[model samples]
Target: MSKLIWKALLASPAILGAAVVAASPASAQQVSSTTVPSVSALEATGDGSTLSNLDQLNQYGREGRARRANSAEQVTSVSQLSDVQPTDWAFQALQSLVERYGCIAGYPDGTYKGNRAMTRYEFAAGLNACLDRIQELLVTNVADYATKADLEVLKKLQDMFKTELAALRGRVDTLEGRISYLEKTQFSTTTKLTGEAIMMLAGATSANLDDLGDAFSGNNGDDNQVVFQNRVRLNFNTSFSGKDLLITRLQVGNSKGFNGVAGETVLTNQVFGDTGNQFTLDTLQYQFPIGEKGRGYLMANAGVWDDISNTLNPYFEDYDGGRGSLSTFSQRSPIYRLGGGAGIGVKYDFSDNWQLSAGYLAGEAANPRSGDGVGEGGLFDGQFSAMAQLTYTNDAKTFGLGLTYNYSYFGEGEFGFDNAGFVSGFTGTLAANVLPQQDAVTSNSVGLQGYYQFSPKVALTGFVGYTGVDSKGGSFDDADIWYYALGLALPDLGKEGNLGGIFVGAQPYLTNIDGDDVKTDIPLQVEVFYKYAVNDWISITPGVIWQVNPNQDNDNDDVVIGTLRTTFVF
Candidate 1:
């Protein structure tokens, strides 16, 4: 499948996993004093702007003072009580402060000690720092304090600390409260919820015209057939958490056919209770943070999992289209398999715009139960599967590209063989020759898919896949199958409320077998769909499906099956 096709085929949600966790609050940087020119040099230059431009000069002076004030406010070293080398003392003291009170930025690696000697200038500067911080705290708590009173307290604190232990303990107490308040108000509460649904209708017709002529006689017959199927499904999802820190989804749907045929007879005539019926538990998954900075998350799911295909629209079951192509990747050709399973995955961002993921799955293959006569179960015999993918995104263009590979390995399974009949319960030699045979089988598959976005509103998508089978006793040689698809999508078309867009796609497939009787051919598939968003809780999708080849029989013309479908998501 192509990237445009995938985005056009299914509704996608923004991924908010580890990306949120890895983000950190922006920090303020210190303005170094070295960048400021000396006061004597400025005065000596006597720039004319100094006096006539005193106002502008005053603004610069005020900015410089503010920078100095900021530095002074955080300085809390107590050099007077130390007797160690200045550099060593400063490093150790800074480390100790960070460890004890969690105050003052410590050494780059984090360490601190108290055995530091004090210098008059250093002591004066440190004491002034404590006083500055004390004023800042007072302003935060007592916003209405008179200017005179505020200044008086500031001066008193500076005078006392400068002569005492060269630090103001009372001022430290006040600063802690301001830091606590800032932390408390740093984050705001926000929530977001998104939902989608689809409804569809389709019709199909098949015609076979043939003629026969012989030297002596001629005979011929013409067959024309039409089949109609209708299905409706509804899926619902609800999620809540800060920036997707936590997520939950729920899905449900029901489907039924209007007019159809199971085999050679009219499906409506089948006395069965429900000739065409289907239901699904589409998706249920949870995502949560795994490490600091939310570099990634741990995701788990239990429900109908969509195959990792590159195409915009899936090949197996178009929940929105009643009649869609059955994926060869599934157990068989005629049925859409839906089963339960559990799996874990991790998505990590290697850079601002790139990410990768790996996941594993284990459970019953979503095909008919093994032991059935259908040849479908050969590849799904209690198998295990794994997948890896990498993606690159450009936020400015709302575009992304991805590459993926998937593999599955099945355990030993039975293989069946058909033989010309002799009779039941016949003699040993004759019986062995008459009855059909069965044996164990194993199979494997590999696939590659890619996606590209042309713009935020449009995308191109497609993918190719291959599978191989191995059997015991050489009853049959290995067989290979391949599929390719391309599609286009229009997002938020017409900007209608709750309405997504429509998409059309086509896929072609081919298969070959290396055995006593060789066979090869290609099948053509097409689909057209309209998706409508009813609201936050529901979306409707209606679509059509056309298969140009039901069987690879070159002697027979193509057969087409029509279907009508509807899906709702909450």
Candidate 2:
């Protein structure tokens, strides 16, 4: 009789799984609240010391019902399961349990779910349902299990695990009480709130007075003074369906870019901008799955291309948040910033390693009356950008590459490249973006981005792009814009959660304008910074930027910027 019970214990795993141990990560219906045991660890037990699986079984051993309703039904025969097949490797073991003790149950959907991951509580629920049937089987057919004397040995088995079973019951009771208290006090069951705050002390100046020609030798605005600035963001994330998400964000800031100065191109701090310290709605986006392999996005406001697609540069891109690079140009390709406000996008996964994405956004989409003017709305008639991209990433995601194409259009008047094409508030320098007044502009751009991780602690990322701009509805001739960047990242530089980085790139510059000699030299930027995570809620990043030919003119002086930034997240 002892041998029979020991054999059941030894063979429990065969009934527990072969496919269960091999289930894919995608099969998890919900994220585990606690760390899950590794597959190898679950496979073999050299000793009975590891009680995780045993605890799982006994968690509901005393209860007559399962945690889920459908899991409580009886499985008198193996044929009752639709997914189980005669060819399955575990078929014989499963049949033995079903025909002998009739102790088995399927998932709520009436499937055995052998390829899905479940928590300890879920496994316990299934095991408890089987235990209930075992009790019934023993009462109805004692002759099959043991004689009358063997029945007394069952009492000894129960006594042997008394303390262990009692401890398991105590844990389950504690968990239930904690869950009840949380439900009574939670802010919202469907929504979660998070926030980030940043403060910076910064200064910028020309590298030398002698290098600056008379064209920019004097009248450097108040950009020279060291100043303090800050920005704060509050995010509310809601989910009605477990697979979908709705995001709403609010922001306020008091920082104005040094671009207001004479020789600067892009802002040194990506998170700081000219907000006048007035709080405003920053983002509203809803995302949900479409069938199985597709996803759709609806951005009502402040939406950019990267929001709908993954930036190939994994460690470098931060979704324009406070954790990564300090400058806007270093965050991602300028093509992603061509036009942004309201937009829609769709993405499909061709395979685990390949993806296709397409999206459109209009910068001036809020206006009701259209015709190349601000405060006038037209979903397709005004300033807009459309893009398509195909990307590939290896299974480990250590190597990634992407190819993208973009078409952007902007009418004259209050629109047309944000600053007469001399510079872009999003990215690029004055020399690269030149559009004559009252002239509409249209551009076709192609770009490629890639990254490789050759070492455990180091990685390399590179991006290059070209944009051909044509003057529409006006007199200016066509032009060309070119840019490239290379980056080196040192993860966990000094400690965990810390990053040290170096980037060298030419923030978009003009190569040709109506065949006119636009610039004699490249407008290059080199940056280095280290972000030190002080804790879960705080970090300090100090960095400097050096720009050659600061104003896109080779004759002008180089510029240097220094900044120390602190961030808090919660």
Candidate 3:
């Protein structure tokens, strides 16, 4: 035993060798010939008298010599010791000590034997060798000699937050696995779902209806009664490539009672019924890139002018039932309604601030024969409007101006005087002055629209439009109409997502009549509204519209309309 201790002490080749020898008493004898036992064995044997500090140090000396003789390969990483794995509870500590302090060495075969029994003697010998190495590093002024101090701090920190760290790691692993599974099992990879719902309570009051010799006046006694309406939409937006989009919309509504056909009511809503209380495919549009500077949209089914135009009237063209203007005329220029049907449109951006847009839409493209098809009486020959607009946006992008022109060809029975084109204040119905089959007209319309943001929360918007109609072979007189409006809007009023607006304007009215003695009355319209957002997903709007002369006739009574609308989005 003395010789083995002397051998291990000399092999250390450091000051620790002298300390080791001095610490052990020469009188102490070997406890047993058996190999040094593990820590658990020492506790189990409980031979405290034989297990002296001097005896243990001498044993460490023997083991250190044996360990050095057998291990030739130096291992710096736990991975280099092939048997070590992260699942082992002590693996992290062993790795830190080996990597950070360069204190651990493996057998020539690269095995750590981490589970092998270890005695206090062997542990002491291992610690002594590590101390020698550290001293060598400090003497050489190596950069990593203070790793032991850092490790002490890290050890205390790890212990202080061990439970939280473990839980966080577990959650991260769970999330990663769940994301992987969802990627494989989720719905369409290219399609996403979106939806909107609207509810409205509305009523209108008017004193009398005018008689115009067979013209439809929508003179109903219940026109002033309050009624409830509902509309819901589900849209699927799909993308095959990154830059293109195809939209499919399914909608249903109970909005049949609000049309102007009832009591000369202004068209206040866009989500009215095609098939009341029944679900239907409302819109199908595809938007794709045309080039680096152009983009285009194709309407395969139910399309509207708002889908094709930038809608210079930026205040309220959302098309949702409960939002935007309470009256249709206040939404945009009536020319937009000239071709509110299926069509294709394109816009080319000359730069960030300038663009040119054009489109053609056929109002009655689903019927055939001499009146309403895509053929002689269809999209090409039936009632259709071709429109173009040039727009300029200011540097701040808060102001814009758009100049628009539209040319529409109307067939004998396809064009109606009740359309939005003539819904303004003074444009009285011309149906009584001409025979349906004998009268076909062509209209040329021009519109100027502009909006400026005076401040972050306030804006001013206005538009002026003119349309002139010429008769083909009918005996009716030609007419010209004019309409204009200026509005003030406050966005994010009271709170975010809220809006308030006031508008003063005139609906379309006849300005001139040729070859006839028909008298036309010019009417004025005033409106005020406020929209309050209850939360991120819901909003409510209340509004009122007053018309000085309803139906563009002097004999008719004034009209007042009131609406309370609520909207939900998801």
Candidate 4:
């Protein structure tokens, strides 16, 4: 085939994959980044036609073909990817593709690590993005390029290069058909809908279920029978400026969680339950640009640090969705969960690999009345936490590092420690099991976390954190808490889009008071799970969770929970 003919065929590869993996576009540079070569700049004339401006894709090799939708600004230069370097073997060879098509395909977390493989589903997503750009160009830019001189050039080529013209037009016809398919299959022009539903069949076995706190505060000798529960979330993501997003999420179902598992709230949904049929607004946030190097977020409700920063655990942290780890403690650093609810945050990238994130959230931002409770502290004085973080990712994107700090204050009677600070209502009783004894409290927490991707198929993530507590108006002088965890992820383990993961960590647990020991045991947690994608909208996961000591009490017996979880995404 002629070079031009070869170029035309490259478009096909971008569409062959059947998966729909969500691609992460470079966010910080969205407002004013470079773009691919334009069709009006190069020539694609037949033998007799005069040379004209053509797209830069012609400069790239066969393997460099790729593109994504412009919903976010596409990276137009290899330098923008940061992870790709000239020293790499494929660097120069892939530059043309990266310069024109957004890193030639990136992971869901926006990393374009070298030589990783792609699943069929993920490739399909690329195809959709390719179709979007191609259709957009054919419908708009091509017509504007049709000058009288250009037509005569084409006429001469059509007559002299009949065979090549025939083949070229044939490819165009195929593309036209694909474009039609795209038009017919689009979700919407202004708004897109995504949703997840998780159903879990679970049961626990423990030597004794007594002395647990919070929901499972008193389980004398009751048998932890098998139970079934579910959680569902629907997200309506709307974008008007292409670079900005308005997110509205709705949640329903019982999240009260398993009966035998006291205070071990792994999932964010573990907070409430037995709602019958009431649907609550789970998240309401707006993400937009701040100048050129910053992205900003305004969260009216249900906001956490994950809303505006990179968590660095793509496989293990699915934003608290059912697709990732089975427990909250394993998903991300407890520091990220410091405070949730109304907040404002921003992420600014100083260079390709370094970013600084800062935010403040108040657990009680709704109620005007003072005192303690959820969403009652107004904006500043209520239960709140302020956060700042500095992070770095390698040029290859295979490694990352972050240093995080959280400063928080909780009111007299508030209880959502694993969430905000020095309170006790969620997670392992030992982790968040403090603060009610005091009239009010303040905390200073520091955390270090990062991840290393060995390849497309395997990755490891680890983190350690510490929170120092000070009594505001209570009997205790000071307290100390600590936690750490490590997780391994194997993607596409048994089949495409399938994942197997294992994690072992200490849930944040109290260790001392006023330089003296507090009666608490190590809150060790071990969790293992595998998710097998049944198709585009469904997946099944089977997992086990073991708690060495519940409620920070060495006297309490260990508890193990085995569960089969099914998830639906759309």
Report the candidate with higher lDDT, 3 versus 4: 4
lDDT score, candidate 2, position 131: 41
Among all windows of ten consecutive residues in candidate 3, which has the lowest summed lDDT? 420-429
C-alpha lDDT (0 to 100) for residue 297 of candidate 1: 33
User: Which portions of model 4 show Cα errors greater than 4 Å?
Assistant: 1-189, 206-223, 259-262, 268-272, 372-375, 420-424, 514-518
Clashes of each: 52, 7, 11, 14
Q: Return the number of clashes found in candidate 4.
A: 14
Which lDDT values do the candidates have, in the order given?
0.34, 0.64, 0.60, 0.64
Worst 10 residues of 2 by lDDT: 30-39
After best superposition, candidate 4 residue 29: deviation in angstroms? Answer: 66
Give residue 220's lDDT in candidate 2 (0 to 100).
38
For model 2 the TM-score comes to: 0.66
**In candidate 1, what are the lDDT values of residues 380-462, reduced to their tens digit?**
45444555666666665345555555554333332111000101110011111111134333434444444466666665555
- Candidate 1 Cα deviation (angstroms), residue 8: 60
The parts of candidate 2 lying over 4 Å away from their true place are: 1-188, 206-222, 259-265, 268-272, 375-377, 413-424, 514-520
Clash count in backbone of candidate 1: 52
Task: For residues 1-570, write the lDDT of model 3, one tens digit per residue.
Answer: 133332332233233323222233341232112123332333344433433533443442333233333555665565444333456444555566557677766664434432132232233233334545655665676755544343233333233322222232333456668989999897657898988888888887744655432333233344457878778888999988978989999888776534232223444443344457688887888999998988898876666666766776566646534566666666766656665456788989999999899987766665465753222355666777788999898889789999999888776544433331222121223322132345677888898888998998898888888888787865456667777889888889999888898988866666566433344666677888998999988999899878775545666677787889888888
- Candidate number of the best TM-score: 2
* Deviation in Å, model 3, residue 421 alpha carbon: 12
lDDT of 4: 0.64
